[model samples]
Target: MTTDNRSTLFSPLTLPTPDGTGFALRNRTILSPMCQYAVDRQDGVATDWHLQHYGAVAAGGFGLLTIESTGVNAAGRISPRDLGMYNETQEAAHRRLVSFIHSQGAAAAVQLNHAGGRASGKPWLPGTHGGSAPLEDGGWQTVGMTDQSIAKGYRPTTKLSKDGIEQIVSDFAAAARRADAAGYDVIQIHAAHGYLLHQSLSPLTNTRDDKYGGTEENRFRLTREVVDAVRAAWPDSKPLGIRISATDWVAGGLDVDVTSRLMRDLVKNHGINWVDVSSGGLVSTPLQPSGPGFHAVLGAQIKRALADTDAVVSVVGGISSPEQAETMLRTGQVDAVSIGRAAMRNPHWPAMAAARLGVPCEDNPAAPQYWRAEW
Candidate 1:
């Protein structure tokens, strides 16, 4: 196969940045951010485990690797072991990781998140899958849009006051500054999976009568503010992106139509350059579909909705097979595919997929040292 004959999955994608100069990705495959929960000291700093873990994926040929959920504040972490972007120590560690990823010919992105009511929970490692970590075990009270539990085993959260909400926005902006300092190519604001921003977006979670809740526009206030703040803080040369659960999968909850509108506005008016679509984290419901390429349709809809803009749309689900991913891209379902568990199972997934898709070996995105490794 020749370069011109290469599959869309192996082709480059340039994401538009605020500066008008685009951020070029070597290929269309992105490594979805997955939590490792390996921070030994629980101080929210990246450790050796993080370096090796992300390094492996970078060398594995991903065009972009999104670092897992990182807290903007200590109390906002999903687990004590999750990463944070607030301090000098964490920022330095992240810089080290980004340098290594770039050396391997990959771009690095960090997902800035505030888990809200879901914070301070047990890591999802074996034998400690669910429930909030007790205070004695280093857990703290979580905060949310309302004083409610996001899930059954999670602790009930304190409702965030107007001041608290403002603080949250400030924290995200501060984190964005740190991310730029760390030399990240992109910053993904995590508004999905029932986090603080998602809580405010979903009617099932946000019931406040204040300006930050109730009507759809009011519910969207916090996320919009955070986006504005981060965009203002972050350098215009780097692209800004977001991960959103396109649907809540239950009646009277957020769905594709609403989220599509949000994406359009974010791309057209705000400074978002990319959107990664996922769904159903506010509450567990059977209505949420499952299986391979589950979020492809939603991604396509959002892509079509943002057709007039230069925003790139990606989808994450059971997108394991190379053929399925290729078909999705070839059919214009999404601009890119975010591989999760499959990438974990095989860190060199992109390299192998490139070979399977018949991309010429010289053009394969694999690290130079791995070029001789038979795919």
Candidate 2:
């Protein structure tokens, strides 16, 4: 058999959005978005810490580097330190960061998110949740599908009205413009992990009868609208993707089947490029599974379900070893492997993985280092 050096984890992946936007990654490894919450000014600007953090991961050799979940609006921030895209100052800050990622030959993506009912103060700090933070202490009134408190020790949330819903769509579009201006190559709409979009998608949290709730179609309306808006604003030459909770881990909640279908529809009508699948976190679910590559099965099902489409699905959660990553990709469990906490724990994981999988790190395109970028 002919030997292609781009074997297993080092294989290239190309995804073209339904609207003609595309990104050809040198490998199937993607740096999953993980919030830093490192901005201390409460202004949502990128800091030197962000530069070092993402810079490390970028140099670690992932084909695509997705920045953390950034707030589309100040009021939608999960913490005061979360990155934001609603202002030029924030956009300018990200430009330098994105430049660094690109200088390393990695495609840069930004995850646009709204915390919804979960918005508040420091998540790492104690005494905060659905009922704790006062408005003056860097916490604003949070909004979601309903005004009911998600839980104790968290900010009580206000229900989003029709105008509020429209505003969210506009906000996402505005964020796309800013991301484009900042030189981000992709925009990953964060609709998963019990955030604003997931809060509305999962029936466990959304109990409204309005057009934006009740039926799955209604619950998916907001996310779909945001996708359409972002697609219009983002460049057609660059890919657009969304990160979604494939399963709520509760009976009668949004599951892989529903998520796969929703993603399919997005590809068919909304110009979606790729899907990053992670499960749970919508509500307190005791049934959530935990283990190595625990969520790959659901992501695999989504990938199988979309076999006819150009859309791709990336799986995250509990994936650390290069063998696991290679196996998942070889078996078609996922189009790409995304790493979160593992990447942070070891920014050199990709290069290390390349070595383990028999792809010489020195020769792998994914392992190339542009020290000039560092200079």
Taking all chains together, each candidate's TM-score versus the true structure is 0.98, 0.94
Task: Give the local distance difference test score of model 2.
Answer: 0.85
Instruction: List lDDT for all candidates, in order.
Output: 0.93, 0.85
Residues 180-271 of candidate 2 have per-residue lDDT tens digits of: 99999889999998888988888888888999899988988888999999999988888899998998888988988898889999987888
* Residue 369, model 2, lDDT: 47
Looking at model 1, residue 156 earns an lDDT score of 94
Model 2: weakest 10-residue lDDT segment is 366-375
The TM-score obtained by model 2 is 0.94
Q: What global local distance difference test value does model 1 have?
A: 0.93
**Between which residue pairs do clashes occur in model 1?**
none
